[model samples]
Target chain A: MTVAAQSEVQVDNAEVRVTEWRLPPGAATGPHRHGMDYVIVPVADGEMTIVAPDGARAKAQLKTGKSYFRKAGVEHDVLNETATEIVFLEVELKV
Target chain B: MTVAAQSEVQVDNAEVRVTEWRLPPGAATGPHRHGMDYVIVPVADGEMTIVAPDGARAKAQLKTGKSYFRKAGVEHDVLNETATEIVFLEVELKV
Candidate 1:
């Protein structure tokens, strides 16, 4: 099977934005929502726990070298449930 | 004082994906474009140089905690112009 790749086009007028997350062991990011559409990429792997807005809690093992996208509007808090430091990247389209 | 925040909505059927990059000093990831829309977040800072498809090269100091958005169709190559290790995150909505 062939792997899909990144897109190629001339996009305009969009500003660049980035966010860094440094989570300590068992620390939570608190409750938050995606104000703008953003992408999440993990540069480091840490056991993560995500709590949905409706109080649904989920835990999963996140690894580096993968990508995930959260919509422009979603409520959740991500916690680095591991004993080691967790780092990730969040990119957003600045309006 | 007011700061715009992340959005909140119940999105469906989108998958989570991630990719990692480990580049040596003066190393390059080759020429490629974004196949899907994605966000870029810098979790770590290093001197980065980006080259657009039209032979346009831009060098900027990328720090952790800033976000940027590249459309689904843009071809660019990013490099760490510094001697230090650089790390970042990319998130994309999987169709």
Candidate 2:
């Protein structure tokens, strides 16, 4: 079984919720679906393996200080396959 | 006159707008107001001088990889007072 990644809720208010995720090598966030629109801010340069619900797989390259956004209802499992730990912040819009 | 900081839009979609901000020493973002709720993810440890419209000043300390959120209607001018360039991502939620 893959090790579970660590997630910490940094902030949650009326307008937004921010969570920080730390993924060690071989760690995974397990399959999940986003309930709200979200933005991802990568803390370091790294890559993640994205596994879709249908078993499709893809690689996501993340650069330090870069951010991206996605709409709600996306389902996937994120895995850290690199030797180094990967850290990122997920900002969920509550509006 | 304080030099103006640089802002680059990284992503703009129906749900969110992501911008990367770079502030060199003594650069400022000029006084502005936030229209949407937002989250800021710092790329490096640094300090910023915040100047309000009334000239009130405050200091904001930022940590690398850490994030914070604010509601809309926040108005201030952000300045980089350190010698090193400071970088961060501003994720605005378009609810």
lDDT for predicted candidate 1 compared with the true structure: 0.60
The DockQ-based CAPRI class assigned to model 1 is: incorrect
- Model 1 misplaced regions, further than 4 Å: A1-14, B1-95
Per residue, candidate 1 scores C-alpha lDDT tens digits across B6-79 of 22222224443444445557667667778876655555676667888887888877565455665688788776
| Quality class of the docking in candidate 2, CAPRI style | high
**Model 2: residues >4 Å from true position, as ranges?**
none
Instruction: List the pairs of residues colliding in candidate 2.
Output: none
Error of 2 at A74 (Å): 1.2
- Against the native complex, each candidate's DockQ, computed on alpha carbons, is 0.15, 0.83
**Which one wins on lDDT?**
2
**Compared with the real two-chain complex, what DockQ does model 1 have?**
0.15
Q: Who wins the DockQ comparison? A: 2
